[model samples]
Target: MTIDGSHAEGLGEVEFDDEKHAEDRQFVRALARGLEILRCFQPQEPLLGNRELAHRTGLPKPTVSRLTHTLVAMGLLEFLPNHEKYRLRSSVLALGYAAAATSGIVELARPIMQRVVDEHGGSFALGVRDRLSMICLIHCHSKAIFTLRMDVGSHVPMLPSAMGRGFLVGLPDHERQFLVDRLARVSRRGGQTTQEIVQRAIDEFKAQGFCASYGEWLHDILSIGAPVISHDRQVVLGLTYSAFSYATARATMNEVMGPQVRQVAAVIGDEITRLRWRP
Candidate 1:
C-alpha cells in the first residue's frame, strides 16, 4: 500500500469525519473536536490561540472559538489573558498523573529496569505504541553523562527508533501492514521510501528476537530493544536501552545490550501476564 503525506499525518492519530459520524447516534463530534483543540497544546508548544488551533486542526475559525471556549469552561484549557492564547490546564496533567500513578506495569518494571541500566550503562525506557510514535511510560536515566533528551511522556518515532521497531515487529501481519502503509509515506531514508528498511528491520527482529538502531533516529544515539508480548501473542510494550555511540560501539550493543534488553522484555512480559493484562 502507498500513503501520501496527509495519510501519514492521520496514521495513529484519531480522525473524525462528520459524514461517517452522522450515521452513529452515539458519536459525539463536538467532543472529538474539542479534544483535538486540547491536544494541540504540548510541553514544547504550550500556548496556542484560536487561529493557530484552527490552522493546526483544520477546523474553521468559528468552530475553534466555540471549542476553545468550551474546553476552557471545562477546565481542560486556560485562557492566557496576557498573551490572548490558551494553554493546557492542570486538569490535563491530572489525567496523566492519574494514569501514571495507576500504571501497574511501570511499578513492576522499575526495579528490573534499574538492574538493566546498572549493567548496560545507558538510559532505559519502557513504552507502548501511540499511533506512529511510542510514548514512554517509564524512563530510567543512565549513570553515564551521555544520554538522549527524553523522559516519561516523551514521544519516540516508530519509523526510526529501536523501541518503535520492536513494537511494530511484534504486531500481527495485517495490523503491521496497515500501520506500515500509513507510516511509509512520511518515513524515508536518503530520499528513498522506508519500506525496504523497515521490512529488513522486522525480518531481523523476527530472526534475532531484537531490533537495533545505530543512529537512525538521533545521529549520536545507539540503541537495542525487544518487545513485551502478551499471553495472546500481542505486543503490549517495548523496552529499549540507549546511549551515546561513542560511549558504546554498535558491535558491543549487538553483542551485549541486545541480550540484556531481551531479558528485561521477557521479565516485563511475564509480569504483565501474571497481572492478567488483556492487551
Candidate 2:
C-alpha cells in the first residue's frame, strides 16, 4: 500500500505481488462480483428482484438467479415472500463479526478503543470504507447516553459523516472528486449543497487535521475522526470518537480530540509497521 501526496501523496495504491498473483486475482474477481450483487441492495433498495439484480450487476438473468440462489443457500441473502425479492439476511453479520474477531488489527484496537473511551468518556470506533460506505469494524461505547451504537456491519455514507470524512480527507484529489460527484448525484439524504460538502472536506483537511461532523448524518450526534496509518504512512483505516448532543462540549472537544486522534493514528501506523500478515 502507498500513501498519496495530497495526504502526503495519496496512499500510493495498494498492489499485490503474491507468488500466486494470477490465482489470487481470480478469487478477487469472484469476490468483487459477489460484492457487486450484494451492493445492489441499499438503504432504499433493500429488496430487489432477479431482474433488478441482473440490471444492477450487469449479469445475465440466469447468472443472477444462480448467484442469488447460491447466496440464499449460504444464508447471506434471503427471499422476501410477499415482495418476491431478495435482501440481505442477518447471517451475513456472522461473517463480518467472525472476520473482525480473527483480525489482528481489530484484536489490538479493541482493547485500545475501550481504554480511550473509558478515559475520555466518549464513544470510539475503528472503521474502513467498503465500496461507497464506511463500515464500523469495532466500537467501544463511552457513555450510557444516546450515543451511536453502530454495530459491526453498520455502513455510513462517505460524505457528510465524520467517520467517512476522516478517511476521505486523506484520499487523493481524484478519488475525493469521484466520491463527491457520485454522492452528489445519488445520495438519498437532504438538500446539502455539494459546494458546502467540498468546502467542509477542505476545512477538515486544513484546520482540525480531522473531520468533525455535527448532526450531519445523525441528528444531535457529534463525531471527530482521523485516519489510521500503516508503517509506510499509508492511511489504511479510520479511528473516531463520538458523543451525544450534550456530552461533547464544543471548545473542549476541539482543543483535545484532534490531537488525541492524531496520536492514535500514529500508534496505528507504528503497530502496522511492526506487525506481520500471515498467509
lDDT of 2 by residue, 1-279 (tens): 111111111111122223445665456755555666776664334679999877756777997888888889888999988999998997775665577767687766777678777787777877787766676777787656655676565566666667777877767778778867766665655566664676686686588677787777666777787777665544467677777767677666678877777777667657766775220
Name the top lDDT candidate: 1
Worst 10 residues of 1 by lDDT: 1-10
lDDT tens digits, residues 147-265, model 1? 55465776677777888888877788788788788787656446545677678778778777788888776767888877888776744677788888887888888888778888889
Models 1 onward score TM values of 0.89, 0.73
Q: After superposition, how far is residue 208 of candidate 1 from its true place, in Å?
A: 2.1
